[model samples]
Target: MAPKDVMTNCHAKSILNAMNALRKSSTLCDVTLRVEQKDFAAHRIVLAACSDYFCAMFTSELSEKDKPYVDIQGLTASTMEILLDFVYTETVHVTVENVQELLPAACLLQLKGVKQACCEFLESQLDPSNCLGIRDFAETHNCVDLMQAAEVFSQKHFPEVVQHEEFILLNREEVEKLIKCDEIQVDSEEPVFEAVINWVKHSKKEREDSLPELLQYVRMPLLTPRYITDVIDTE
Candidate 1:
């Protein structure tokens, strides 16, 4: 054979490191992505390779295809920098401080790996105080697994969760949905009933009408006979 092909195991990583170096030095970068009035120099090819959002913009007939500078609105500069770090280095730091912002940015960029990382971080950070909020956030972002995890965490700590302001602020529908779930862990039906009353009393003017409807799910049969004769009858 006149020639034989050779492949280097470190070739990919070596190229990435070199590209990162060039990007930091502003060498041979073909595009500038501006976010929140901050400029980030990068190669269109590199960005396209990592994110489908960038790929579509660069390959399509849109006006941005040939534009040397593109402004990405609704994205913070810090979030953009974190995303660029992930694209160039194949790694990212997903922390509580940045995750809320980073996950949305990653979602917009079509970076599934980064989004999954953010979801995992949120899942790990779930607690009685924040589980309800995290559950809503996960649902809003379509992170099904994280949402389920947060839901379970909320129900597992239902007694404590009811003490948080997030629980008190829930609208009628959300309150009803949680109390109806069989998965909620409570010492007894007393806590369940109390949770419902507490949520309603938080905004009585707007929520009092729904109390009668929510009370129907309190599972009267599950309540102790003494509670019915004493607490339930009085309330």
Candidate 2:
């Protein structure tokens, strides 16, 4: 083999050795640290070196079986740089994927910087358009704080978004669908749901009260003789 090929093989072997060392390392907090299969080929070395830090933040194993299948092949250096910066700066844009995983990791290792980043990201992303997905992600990751923030954002923005004719006309089933989609709890005793229900009720009541006034304006006046004579006498 050429010298370049020999060097490449040596580098690959070294990375594999580092990964094995990480896999066999003692659990930091009763959680096994294994390279995610999706991240193994390219990021195994980097991830393995960071295992102890990750273990400190995460209670669950880091094995491939735990997370959804994702393709990280196209991850750019810039992305990694941003992630690292977020970890340090504790500020990040929340629209990035796999944030659920990243946030936990940040919390576990006492990466207050990263945790702050996750919070900021979630705050910015919490809105009527994407609140449901954010709520799901938070619940799945057991992120209570994120969930609460999302609830607040949804409740604040819901009135403006749900006042449309389509939303006003939604049946119970349709409303439930929106609730589920937005990750808003329909059965929970939380104030968020309570506030939403109150808002809807108030809007409906206003519409109902306006109907009588609207009818009075549209109705034709009666042409009774008594009313005509009264009007003539007044004239």
Over 145-197, each residue of candidate 2 has an lDDT whose tens digit, in order, gives: 88778766655565444544444554544454444444533333233333334
**Candidate 1's TM-score:** 0.89
RMSD of 2: 16.8
Lowest lDDT sum, 10 consecutive residues, model 1, at 226-235
- The residue-by-residue lDDT of candidate 1 on 67-159, one tens digit each, is 999999878999999999999998999987899999989889998889999998898899889999999998888899999999999989999
TM-score of 2: 0.34
Best by TM-score: 1
Q: Once superposed on the true structure, which residue ranges of model 1 sit more than 4 Å away at CA? A: 1-9, 221-235
TM-scores for every candidate against the unseen true structure: 0.89, 0.34
